[model samples]
Each structure stands twice: as C-alpha cells, then as structure tokens.
Target chain A: MANILTQNDIQHVDYKDIDLLKQFVNPHGRVMSRKRTALTAKQQRAVEAAVKRARFMGLLPFIQK
Target chain B: MEMETNLSEEGGVSRVYEIGYLIVPTVAEDSLDKVVGEIRSSIEKAGGSFIAEGAPSLMRLAYDMTAREGDKNVDYDRGYFGWLKFEASPESAIALEESLRTNASVLRHIVFRTVREDTRAKIKAPTLREVKTPRTTLAAPRREEEVSAPVSEVDLDKALEDLTTE
Candidate 1:
C-alpha cells in the first residue's frame, strides 16, 4: 500500500489533526507499526510522536476502554 | 526527555517552545479571556516572547479527566483547549511549565521545543480525479481475432468437413 502521508504530501504530522492522526492509530488506541501503516521510518516516528502528544492533550485516548 | 536548547556565541541559551494547555471547563465564557491572559502574563514573567497562539475554545474530551478543585477532585468531560508558541530560554520554559502544573485553572499542559516556521498541515478535502474513457478516435488497435471478418456459412461448413475428414 502507498504511504498515506507521502500520498497526501503531508510534511508535518500534527497532533491537533485528530482525524488525520487517527489513521495511524488502531482501534485499541495504539500506534500502528510502519509495516501496517506503510509509512517511511521518519514518517512513522513523526506519527508516533504526534499520537503520544494527542493522547496527553485528551484529544486522543490512550486506550479505547 | 532531554531538552534541546540553542546556545549562542554570547553564552545565552534559548529555544522556541510551544505550549498546549487545557483550561477547566467550569470557567465562564466571559472570563475565558482572563484565564488566557493569565497564561500569557505567566509566560511573559518567565522572559518568554510570544510568537503565535491559538485561543482557547470549548471542546469535548476523549475521556473523563479529574482535576483537583480546592477540596475535591472534579471530573470533567470537556475543556477549553489553547496553545501558545514562543521563544524562551530553556530554564525559563521549564520554570513556566512547573508553575502551570500548580495552576488550578489549567487541568493539563505541555511545552515542547519546535521551529518558528508553521509546520502544521492544512486540512483539506481530497479532490476527486476525473475518470476519462478512451476516445473512439484514439482507440487501441484491435486484436487479430476481433478484427477478423466473420466466416461465411459455406466456409464454416468447408472447415468442419475438412476437420472431420482429418
């Protein structure tokens, strides 16, 4: 599968963009692996960091339950 | 996490930091500005200069969060979210974060080093690509089988007879 960020030409992964970030998170509220997300290593890192930040801000949950 | 700070030749250290905070939802709409202003003043007091900011707006939380209010822990399902981007020395930024932790009005906050440039991606609807059918004038060359003329009944009978005989 094509890398979503690369396909969209998204240069920055922002934690405030919950909708976009949700694509990188699984239903369990865990960040998906690079193989699953089909993201470059750098892109995966950025997404992971953004997801963690979003979770801290209560914009995203740490766990679904 | 290790803090990243830029040290100038003059021995001064500073870094660009962005702080995102959640204000208690109990604050009245009219007094929201005052709470935001207090945050600004606190940053200013820490010797930080403002760069950009997002005003606090009421938003639903993903989960219930509890914050101490005087004598009791109050559960909140919503909050006023805001952020400020500024330049400050590493020491002062840490100091400001410590102060915000103790602030009763602010339920949660985070300060992280970032660049001055706007790195946020604009949310936009995906554009649908137009599907174009091949034009008749530019149609692909037909295969031999498809381009071949239909066999006459006599020719078909002759071919069948020949096959049977073989």
Candidate 2:
C-alpha cells in the first residue's frame, strides 16, 4: 500500500489519533516496520513515538492477545 | 515569588510540555469540573502557564486496566480522557508529575516536552491522478489480438522519434 501519511499530507502524528495509528499496528499490537509501512525514516520515528505515547495513555493496547 | 526566585537561581529554563491523562470512571459527571479545576490550579501553583487543553470526555479504553484503590485493585474499561499543553520549568514539571501520581482520581498520565506550535496531524483526502492511455491506431481500435502482438522495427523507431520530438 502507498504511504498513508504522505498521501494525506500529514506531517506530525498525534498520539490521540488512535484510529489512524491502529492501521500501522499488526494483529499482535506490534508496530509495523518501515519496510512494511513504506514510510520515510522521519515518518517512521514519528509514528513510533506516537504509538508509544498512545499506549501509555491506554488509548492503544500494548499487547493484544 | 519565592518559587520564582528559586527557579531563577537554578538557571531553570521553561519548556513546553503536554500532559495527557485518564481520570477514573468512578468520578461523578457533575464533579468532573472540580477535578479539572484541581489540575489547573496545580499547574498554576507550579508556575506553569496553560497554552491549550481538551476538556475531559468519557471514552472506552482499548483494554481493561487496573488501578489500585485503597487495598484492592479495580479494573476499568472506560475513563475520562483529557490533555493540556503548558509551559513550565523542568523542575516544576517534575514536581507537577509527582503530585498527579498521588491523586487517586487519576488512573494514568503522561507528560512530555513538546513545542508551542500545534503539531497534530490534519489528515486530508488523497488526490487522484488522471491516467492517459496512448492510442496506437487512428482508425478503428486495434483488436485485442493485434494489441498484444510484437511491434515491427519500423514502428519502434517511429515511436522513439515521436518521443524525442515531443
């Protein structure tokens, strides 16, 4: 799939946006790699940080069994 | 005044921080304002100035989370979520976090350094590209069989010439 953030012109990823962040996570609740997501290094870092923050706030699950 | 002097003596530099929190679902809706007011007052007490905030709203949690209450742990499937952006000295920020940690009404919280400008993503619709199909024949469209057939050397050269001229 094409880069969703690049396609939508999204520069910064907000941790509160769990709906959008969920797309980058796998069934196990693990973050997808840059290769799998086809995102730039900067974009990948932003997504990683946002996901971690969301997990801390219980907005996203850390592990999905 | 005393706190300001102490901070200045330590050469403390104020930095922007955003705190996101989850309030225990047990809190009555009518008393939600009182809880929010407590947080705002704490920020002011810490010499922090508010930049922006999202009022607490009830929301379902992604998974069941347990927080200690008295001697027992209570599982929660929902909570009031909210966030606030402010500027405060690093020392005061840490102190503010400590205070929140002891508040029984707070289920979870996170504070991190951030910029004053809004950095949240604004998703937009993807723009579609128009594709142009080249017409191989001017007369009746070439049959599907002919379309897949190999082009002659003459046609290849003509196509190259057309591309270069364009």
Models, CA RMSD each: 9.7, 12.8
Chain A TM-score, candidate 1? Answer: 0.95
Candidate 1: chain B TM-score against the reference chain B: 0.69
Kindly list the per-residue Cα lDDT of model 1 for residues B23-55, writing each as its tens digit. Answer: 999899899899889888988997778989999
CA deviation > 4 Å runs, candidate 1: B1-10, B125-166
**Pairs of residues clashing in candidate 2:** none
Tens-place lDDT per residue, model 2, B1-166, is 0112223444777778889989999999999898889888899998888989999999988888899888998999999999999988888888889988988899999998777767666652223222344565455665676456788999999999999999
Which regions of candidate 2 deviate over 4 angstroms? B1-11, B124-166
DockQ of each: 0.38, 0.35
Best prediction by TM-score: 1
